[model samples]
Target: MSFSRIKRACAVALFCLTLSATQINAQQKRTKGCLTECQPRIGIVSAFGGEAEVLLAETINKQEYVINGNLYTTGILRGNHVVIVLTGISIENATMVTQLTIDHFNIHHLLLSGIAGGVNPDYKVGDVLIPRRWAQPLEVYWSANSNVPAPCGTPRDLSCLGLKLSRFTSQPNSDYQIPTPNGPVGTGLFMRDTFVRNNSNFPNGEFKFDYAADPEMYAVAQTIAPKLDRCGPKNPSLCVAVQPRIRRGGRGISGPAFLANPDYRRYVFKTIRAVSVDMETTAFAHVAYANEIPFIAFRSLSDLAGGDDFTDVSALFASGLAESNSSRVTLGFLEAWSQKYPE
Candidate 1:
């Protein structure tokens, strides 16, 4: 019942298919911007507003991009194409923003600049430290022990007793043995998640305990370190009795705790040999390592982490000075790096 009807039906079907394809293409374009080669850019990340503001001030031709409630600024800093963002103040926030930055931008390198508590007595207020490696000291497993005193000759130390720990059940089981006067005893164990990322540069099947900063960047930072100012108008009284100098190539640790206990500070210094401690760098470092991005961190000490007093000095006056010193060195690094690797 008719050639024209059949021809019209075929034409209608063809038109619908074409329209569907067009809509699909449009949706894809909307969801993900046009795929193209991304310009090489460096990422400058800071933990909080104070840390970020210093870097922001150095940016020229700056433009802001708000994605998923995080602010990213793209601009030219010290003659390099760079994007800067703030990763709030904790591990969770730091991790989230780091991955987001890597996913959404063409970041070739990452630099985390911020303030930290001085762990190494050699480092004092307003001293900037560029640690070669970063780790989370708080990532551990705890063993439970009863208050009951150990039998004589059984050893009074809880760690010297063999105890089956309960935490980290999902991780591979291992016993931590601590030696005492009695003998090596099995305490609780700690094992980093080995399956986090599979990278040939890292130990296979083992989550790396420490993430190293790019050595090339570290070298560059060292050259610029001397030019940074140790004292500033923000806090002249808090300046180190001795001239505050930049310290490079040391361990930096991060944790959730706002560390201010003298005993814990001593423990951290003895255990990790960390020169500086902060709350965000290690988390960001971990993410960067997983993504195989080159990273370096510049942390200025705002106060002695319980070496001087328990009161929080970061909020009092030293924060600005720390930020200034760190930013100064960061700018110097960028300028020197640009001279070496002109874009």
Candidate 2:
């Protein structure tokens, strides 16, 4: 071959190689962008390690990512794509991790599964309750005592006390007799609605107590009412008196405190009309609402909050059953969800 022809052929080959390299780089950038923007997996969050043990064990193709000291395991769970994570065990922890999960991953829906104290007497140990909505009832004002001329009744009337109910014209408690949202959960603690920002809908926000779960997701949960496992594998002898059932809808409340008092439980059941009470649901709900993502919580009743007239079973005794029950329902819900959102 001629020297000029050989040199020209080499230059042509180099041009083709550069063109291929440029195309590959462009494709890589596009792939990276899609991964960051188009996340369609369900986010399954638990409050503690034990609560998520069953789900974590069952997850297939698990790949873990630790961000800011929080562990997130991404995998396919029960035929649906999901990312499972433990958000610690408090309202603050829940809020922080939920937002973190939302921020870091492309989450289409957020589902929280864990054990909660059954506020309503109707629900017993091992029963699962998926609340229609969740709220933080601990947003209260610790008011100063208003000395109202000697005896202020045995319980000390909240009206007589100097506690103020924000955004409420009349209290929702027995003394007021007015149907309202805000009320005094305790003597000095006056409950009020939480004010949250509109993260996506910038410069606009609302003041409300109840943050509702996704209607479609809630409906799917309601469809599956299978009997839950009443006994744990570790202790076959220890079983709940009644076969566990799943209840959907009604109010669910969350707060910073772990409620174990009978009188307070009665007040929560009667005044708040909450079906379940936990430490993290409302925080997750709040973040889900702010970020405008579909959200739901599956809370298995570990024990009756306050243990009023019921079998005084500690949460410790029922924790295994409750966690199992919650995870079962979560799997059911995810299975149903796959039908609607198959990817």
Tell me the whole-model lDDT of each prediction, alpha carbons only.
0.72, 0.75
Clashes of each: 0, 0
Residue 185 local lDDT, model 1: 55
In model 2, where is the ten-residue run with the lowest total lDDT? 169-178
- Residue 118 Cα positional deviation in candidate 2, in Å, after optimal superposition: 1.3
Weakest lDDT window of 10 consecutive positions for candidate 1:
164-173
- Angstrom error at residue 341, model 1: 0.9
> Tens digits of per-residue lDDT for model 1 on 42-139?
98888757758878988999988887899889889999999899988898899898888877778889999988888987666667789999977567
Best by lDDT: 2
Model 2 clash pairs are none
Task: Show model 1 residue runs off by greater than 4 Å.
Answer: 1-37, 145-195, 199-205, 234-240, 310-319
- Candidate 1 lDDT at 328 equals 79
User: lDDT by residue for model 2 over 209-281, one digit each (tens)?
Assistant: 7899999898888777565887865566667788888888899999999988766676666776889899999
